[model samples]
Target: MKVHFILHSFNASCMDHNTLKFCVFLILVGLLVNISFAKNDFENCKRVVKVWADSSLDKEIGEDNHKLRDLLFFLHIPRTGGRTYFQCFLKKLYPGYLECPRSYDKLRFDPRKKKCRLLVTHDDYSMISKLPRQRTSVVTILRDPIDRVFSTYEFSIEVAARFLVHPNLTSVTQMTKRLRSKTKGISTLDIWPWKYLVPWMREDLFARRDARYSRGLNTTESNDSYDMEDFAMPLKEYINHPASGDIVHNGATFQVAGLTNNSYIAEAHEVRHCVQKYKILGKFVLQVAKKRLDDMLYVGLTEDHRESATMFANVVGAQVISQLNAANSSLDIGDKIEQRSFPDSDPHSSEHQNSTSDRGASKVTSSESGETAELNITVGELMNSYEGCISNLRTSYSGRRIASLKRISPVNFSREARLQVSEEVLQEIRSLNDLDIELYEYARAIFYRQHKTTLQTFTEERWNNIPSIVYGITLWKVLPLAITCVFLLFLFLVIVNVRRRTLKIKMKVMKS
Candidate 1:
């Protein structure tokens, strides 16, 4: 009897241990299954959000009656398609209010002209704060920082080349001349014919060197004599220089955060704080940014310029016309031709003739008549000479001729060239623009969330239009729950069957 009791106790102990082990295993399996289901559910949610967003976007294709009472302030970040936005869309849409000032001090709002609806500027964060919050609606476009920096460099080079080859005018002197001309009273830079071509006139011009140095230096030079103490030296040496403090480092972040001068360093924490005022909350919260972003009238993206332009038109209560396309077509060839022909068409024009005598008089001592004629060469011929200079520089610096500017697409050249950058150099760029990278990521996240929220609202608004059966079932919300409940029931049944089988075996042994 004693032996049987001890054996029974031991068997019971073993059974309890086995049951506990099985329970633990089941618990682990349940946890894993739940995690997997949760992951899948999250992905499904994202897909639903995307679908809803797309549907909402489709509805907004030709939307109307979007005019608002507030003044639109477009914060134009350099090299981020400001030219395209202003030239192709905004200028036509708001001709009365297209004010592009070089600096914050120069930006003037006419209290008398309440129709002043728009102000586009390269002025940084502080400018927005100065405006009446109730009346001002800020809108801006952002780009990949690395790409923006490269584009800035290339654009600076091109503008410098145009300046050097034609008349070798300093940006300040040229601006002074313009200010002295009849166009002096004009508030906006766009009034000038060369408005789009003279981005170098801005005080915050990113390029530090002349066109020759910018185009001629080899960035990858292994020369031992060259100094590498300054970060910007490499950029001056090579066209493909990686990101550094001297270049347009954290340019997007600085611009968005309202830091005007490049002298300011981009500290991540400080930037987060600075942008917080514009954000929904005064803390580092992405949700705040998302909310604020949704409140904006329009946020354009350069990559999606056409669609953005349409959206912009809708917001301003303007008719989307074929003028933009026509304008772009004309700009592509017309502007270049005009710029080249301007000097030649009227070599004896008062503007050139007056300046030529003062500057060319000294250089003309060798051959007076020949020098004067040479100075009167058409822009095309001048550009050819410039190209020859660039070619020679390229050969001297890199031991090979670089691609002609005409062959490269201005918008896409930097993007395509960046892929060819070495991994080490790429890493250096990433490190230099860490704050920009963070800010960009944050902005993107907020943008997506805003997009999702917009879609969700649209979806809810259109809920009644959905078929009764689909609406009644609320399939998107109910399907997952239904599947989960069914799975749990199946699992419960299996557990009950296993328990019953174990109990029956124990009873049979006891009975025997």
Candidate 2:
């Protein structure tokens, strides 16, 4: 009522007020709106003080304390230190046989058939529907959306540039069927949404660099030899491009809510389907995202690698790692650790297996500065380039190891440098990722609140001795002797007590 009255009064006063008075009135209205939004923002996310208060326990395979049996789903947002978390921590904490095959290009995960305990994937929140009815807890890591966007742009450019330089950039085909394959191989450049954005970036960047050369920037440089990292388009151009809609705009919110502008999933249309999937979450996206965040067991931040890792070890690790001892007792856990550090690994894959069928089928023709050239992309070249892109991505990304997260390190392994953007571009990025910004802030606050009362951070001693202390593992050679000695000592003490009791009874009888 108060706001209504104030607004009505402003409406009336606006007709008679001078310019100065009108400006003051507008300022007052702005303050009112800001205050209301501030309150709503606070109300959206509950201030969580306890971390494990909501962690549910379950009985699975005769194990009552196995809370992780309730589906340890890791909602891995791209470029969010996810590789480090999975490679360094999750693999160490759980056996490989327990991890679900990754569902990247495809979205089919059946826990009932697979009987997998851990789920780590890049699928969106829509994955909840595809999953069968079961108890699951979602955990994820968030980044400052601005930094995430820049990293994404940087990584895309890096991948595209490599594709441009590769010998198989245009000439490779006859790819074998990999239906059940976990390697998410992208076979074409005309895929929906943001997949094509990579090729678009490639073309734009080539044009951008060629223009520089024409202006006599580096005429002395070789025609064929060049740095692979030099073709990244300018920050403003990359973010503002028409192709960046789905991939760049409020990605965190979209991933969290699993929302698409459809009454149903994958609805087809003549024209709408052809248009790229628009990814900026609409009104109430944050509300849905915040509720989803609140429902999660934990939401980690990319920036707070140490604190996040420690909190996860203390909170989530106790649920899963506490049960690994029985599985790895005779087996060396160090040997059971992650053998495959990266996701794009497949030994059975062959490059030249079907080259005869696709010798000159799929080729890309690109022209720059009125010079034309046709480059063929065979299946071998495409797979090889994709694999190299993965390698380059690995070089660019570095996450803290679980064992080393507790300690500080001086060496920096990340090839991705801190990017600088113009003020206008920064503001534009902020505008585009506003929802993610708010969501990240709420997650950060909850993280601190959850850890505010905990005293000890996860230590290396605990990491090394997890099986022994938590999983009840004993030394293989000494366990039997220790058990026998305990039994013998108990037997001897029982005999001595019985003898003393008999002696007491006889003495009492003689005295009587």
Candidate 3:
């Protein structure tokens, strides 16, 4: 009996030890899971904050009306630092107010009836005009027309090369040579102009439905909830037709090539009928169909006085950067740090991968001419540029038109405002010193260059009550750990209960 008792005691001790080991294993697993989740969340949060560091985040800048509603238009110029800005602003201030559409078409269609605080896309003014922008701030960044064209070309070639579409043209120089080549047998697919122009010509720019000629366009049907980064397609397809330009099909679509008697042509167009419309007839014919189609004449922020352009840019940057800094600071992105360093420069190579360097190099340069030609953009410019243009039309752009003057007040954007915006954010942007001094040069270069500019003079009244939009990475990270702990705790309790019950049964058997 003593020997049997000793054996039973040893067995029980061994069982208890095994049970303890199992519980410890569960706990270890739980901790690992939790830590994994927390780390993921932390990274996500940092990503969100980093996005705002880009100057492009101001794409969603707007004001809340007395009705307590948000209204803003999003300008998504891909690879234009727009992603970072939108993500940061949405995460920090806008929260539920903004939507980033993967493709411009789906975003427009889905939100046709829905009023939103912010709507951003690579879409054109025509598509955005359909949105309720009566009280919203409509804004977009324009790159130097030449650089914009260059980027579009480069991006297209990269896509084409990936699919092995163009064999002879592997690099930009080679592609340029191939493009300029007068080969008679060259297929439209083999050349740039043909490939770029085919879709535009094939598609009925005026037709609401997709044309059979353009059947080779973006093969994917519209998806309401597509994410841009995850989207993929053949390189040939992306460049052949951009979805942003697809807004031509929407109700407010601008007919770039329409044959109507009454038409508004973009200032960029050189057609006799078009130039006559703006310069001669002055009828205010709608060319770029947008929310305020009649009002959007390319206006220079200042009367051909060059200094105003620089000041305007700084003000815009200051406003945007200040808000972004506050937003970046509010997030508790648990402990990951961003790798903040400029990329190395590559001078010998034609196409380099350093995003920062590429951005720096693309700043606008003046043509041989000393002054840049003004586009008929802002009404403020119309009033200032041509004598008696605004008074003759008796028209006013919808926004609070900064009065027409050769020189704008530089005093408004104070030094204090610039200091409030983070120097770190400013570090990301290409400095204005590298760009042409003209308004168009600065505007276009700033828009295209990939960098973060600080907004030192942001108005507290605009974003006062808004909570920083945090990336949900922390919740994602900690959730795993929490789940593991809870699961382990539950398992431990169950084990204890089972052991007690088993012991009670054994004792009863022994007594019996």
Candidate 4:
């Protein structure tokens, strides 16, 4: 019909008023078409691009359902209680050979290079492409964005203060080696972010040093705790520093989306340019990061330590239950759930020693063999296992461990750091990290859903997976309908004008 209208209009007199009106009408229609095409396909997709994972297709559990995935990837975002979580949970689950080496500065953690069952790193989501696509489950924990910013800044200063104290250590490698040698093995310093982050921070922040900052260090206070107050940085000055930009910006969003500093998907920036910059970037990042978070089997939270630990046990660690069942045929579903932990005779050792041994055909072993035996907690035995190495995460991570560490760690000073920031500055931090804030909210939603419905049978999980209120419409879908409406309106106007012209021409001929 559009073709017929165009042909009919063109077939009219070249010099006629009807022809001129038709030309103007065509120009207007073309402009509308151009405007529609000029906008990004993602702009309309903004809120409308729904993020839901479906698995209802396979109703029954297959034979392979009991087997573990190829890899368990811990997408560790810094300053999110990741260290404590890794120590308490993940480090216990996979024995040393099965676990990837601790990687902070190194980004390339392909299992092929160094074979391991689990990969834990501070690298962003972009590392997903280099990994084996099949059956690689990812997990991460999130912190409140404002608190995370504060923690990051304070931690950087703490690390820098330590670096300044040891003036002989010129590089992270030297420092890592020194700590490793002093501790006689893999120490906290060996794997911590200070390995790569501290040297640069010392160079950047500590241009001029004062003795008062480190003077009180190593002194036993009234309670016998190390004085860490002198290490704190002013929040406002830290926020303004160029070095702090990556730490304070929408860090969680960028890290989760693989759009962090010096590296980003060009498409995301392009989409931002074509739409409302802040709004569109936040939505684009939230959608992508939310999808990644959904892909993970479990997500922990810094604040909700106990709940996160419980969820991690049920969701990500369920395979351990299956492995235990396979290892011992006499074991019932409700039997004791204990697996082997490596290199730690004492389950709750702070040293948490690792092995450099070859991969074991079997993951769990008997305590008689000298390996650290972890009581694998079955669903029925979860409450009791809360006292063990990993499950102790429920207890230790909740309040006990952090509180104990506060006596010596910088956490004791974090309250003072937070108190220094005014309400306005805190709000400014929120504004800067709006995407991370949104991402964290979505993380909370995923966390809730994992606990609520993820444990159900596959069909039920799929059936309930669709969020009733979250069906997003892509602007891509809206554009076609908009174009159709514009075309119909233009057609109506053209027809009305053509009819008026026909009547006027007939009347003139009749008078002649």
For model 2, give the RMSD to the true fold: 18.0
- Model 4 weakest 10-residue run by lDDT: 51-60
Summarize candidate 4's per-residue lDDT along 110-223 as a digit string, tens digits. Answer: 344334567777777666655664656677899999888877765655555545544443564586676656654543333334444445555543443344335645433232
Clashing pairs in 4: 44-475, 45-475, 48-472, 48-473, 337-375, 337-376, 337-377, 338-375, 338-376
Report lDDT per candidate: 0.44, 0.52, 0.33, 0.56
* Model number with the top lDDT: 4
lDDT of 3 by residue, 211-271 (tens): 3224543333423111111122222233234442222111112221121121222322223
**Over the stretch 380-411, how does candidate 2's per-residue lDDT look in tens digits?**
34334434444544554323121221111121
lDDT of 4 at 87: 59
Best by TM-score: 4
3 or 4, greater by lDDT: 4
TM-score of 1: 0.43
Better of 1 and 4 by lDDT: 4
Lowest summed lDDT across 10 adjacent residues in model 3 is found at 404-413
Clashes of each: 2, 10, 29, 9
Cα deviation at 127, candidate 4, in Å, is 1.5
